[model samples]
Target: MTDPNAPVTVTPADDMPASSAKAVQALALKHLYIAWVRFQRRPESMRSFIGYDLLYFPPPYAAKWAKPFGYIRQAASTIAAIRRHKPDVLWFQSPPTFFAHLLVAYRALGGRRLKVVADCHNMGLDPDVPGNFWMKIPGTIPALNSFDVVIAHNAAVGAKAAGLGVRSDRLLVLETRPAPLPVDETAGDPVPQVILVPCSYHDDEPIEMLMEVAARVPDATFKLTGNLARAQSKNYPARAPANVQFTGYLSAEAYTHLLTNCSLVIGLTTGEGIQLSGANEAVGAGRPMVLSDTQLLRSLFGDAALFAANETAPMAAAVQDALSRQGELRQASRTLKDKRERRWRLQAEACLERLVP
Candidate 1:
């Protein structure tokens, strides 16, 4: 247990255990740390935690398996990070996969002083990506108990985490935040040929339904982003139709450009504990949204979004309706700006509150 009397410090790292490769860590060292360097230059320094410009120390050689070797090496770096910074609370975002188990092992083996808060960002059951029993304890859901608090982005995910043994009080529900995306109120006019769908192509996304929707709404083209691999098609057994274009990975400028100019942004996700980044982007840019009927999106978007059942015919109808009610939907999207603008601050403040005096 962390010492209550000790100096409270909080820090967030892109610490997804499963995917934290040396190459990925290098990006954090360069991009994330470099951004911190720039932020500190302005003098109104963030008060919660004192961290080095560089966040992660990836191991030199990549190992092939998960066990005492790969697991212990990753845990050691995280342990070392805690000891060096001596944070009362360390906020690790996502993948209860390895890190959560690591923390449990750390505490049982040696670590006890730092409080671990697992920010279960986009955390869900993820039936598609089965955990390897060969990896010793499968996925990260079992690691929820180690954390003092389990932060979930949506209530559906929070409930899932609760089912995994995280106490109710320990579960904090933070909404999908509004990003610093470019906005264009009068976008997608005259040449409204695009309907943007932002997805990671996970199993949770119903690609067959998307294909059917595309065929139904032939007037507007569907542009899907997220650089998601087409191999995910193996999950649905349905290929994307002709009108649907996959631009794959997009740069920040390109993403903003696309979102700003797109006619309708569709959040056609099929599960919970996920984000509609594309829908959020559409809202920011004052573009109408056709969202999947999930409690989370409904709560955030309210009447602003055109709610569609996660099916072919209904979703297609919703898309058509959005096209017809473009003016009203645009107004609704603009109204969301007030809500979206405050999200980043609210999320930041909520996290900061955990790192108290």
Candidate 2:
């Protein structure tokens, strides 16, 4: 995260010829016509894909009494978008318990012509706890049956989907992969001391634990980046040690710069569904990581990461170990980066072919 105190500057894109600009604009329009349908039951918020012209369906409700009606309104809006956009593919991030029934409605209304894909980022439920057996309720079962394709973020999630009766051919395991680190390694001396913790500061997140660890590792400065408004509104703990700084929201380039220079990365999410993009970015940049002992983290990093139990003492120890053996960790990080790049490229190609063919 850039120092909030530092002066921010705007840089223009390199000059492009008139012909090239026109060609690029035309290509964007063609892709725009081939929209990707997304069902966002939550209120308008800055998610990762905010810039994309994907359809959003915000669940309605100001009071607890109107929750059910709000969901119905959102589902109706989702159906309307599907009919209007008629996207080649219907991609859902995950099935929320309150809105899973909407999938069945979409399939019935949109018909079999549109391909339905469920991108499973976690096991069919919350991350910290094992999935509730009752999630196999009838409402969820039919919704799972509606998808033409199922994409899991990891092999474990793929297996879980299969166990829930999704066919093997329909399931695609696309592991979270990091974008290539920028080639310009011109970050100056002393590295401006930064450590990034990216994720929502929700209750399940081990924010307090991380804060304790940060307090212990005073030498390595820490920076927290994510939805700061939500954090503040939700009353998330604001007592981060004096050394820790918060960067509300950052542009892609700014965040990437911090990741490149940061000495280490730390994540303490408990959700099995939590995919650690920052961890992958850290690995790509050959930086050491200290992560919580969640199933998703274990599968993604294997033995490459320094893992600790949720408690503060163990978490602190893991961070210390990562800092101590930084060299070995950096080498392991490079190996993971190579493997992820190849896997993601292959998966992306396959997805594009399926969409455009």
lDDT of 1 by residue, 234-300 (tens): 5432376778887766764677778777778898776654556566667667888888998778877
* Clash pairs for candidate 1: 96-140, 97-140
Tens-digit per-residue lDDT, 1-357, candidate 2: 332212122111221211333323322221211111222111011111111234434334556589678767766666666566555556665545334466676456654366565655463533333434335546664565655656666776666667767676567776665545652344332344466787656655777677788899888788888867656665544677887877876765677678777767887777665666668777767777888898778878874788888898998888777777766777777788778766664653444343332
Clash number by candidate, in order = 2, 3
Off by more than 4 A, model 1: 1-89, 106-115, 122-142, 186-192, 231-238, 272-275, 340-348
- lDDT for model 1 comes to 0.59
User: In candidate 1, residue 207 scores what lDDT?
Assistant: 71
Q: lDDT scores for all predictions?
A: 0.59, 0.59
Q: Where does the lowest 10-residue lDDT sum fall in candidate 2?
A: 41-50
For model 1, where is the 10-residue window of minimal lDDT?
34-43
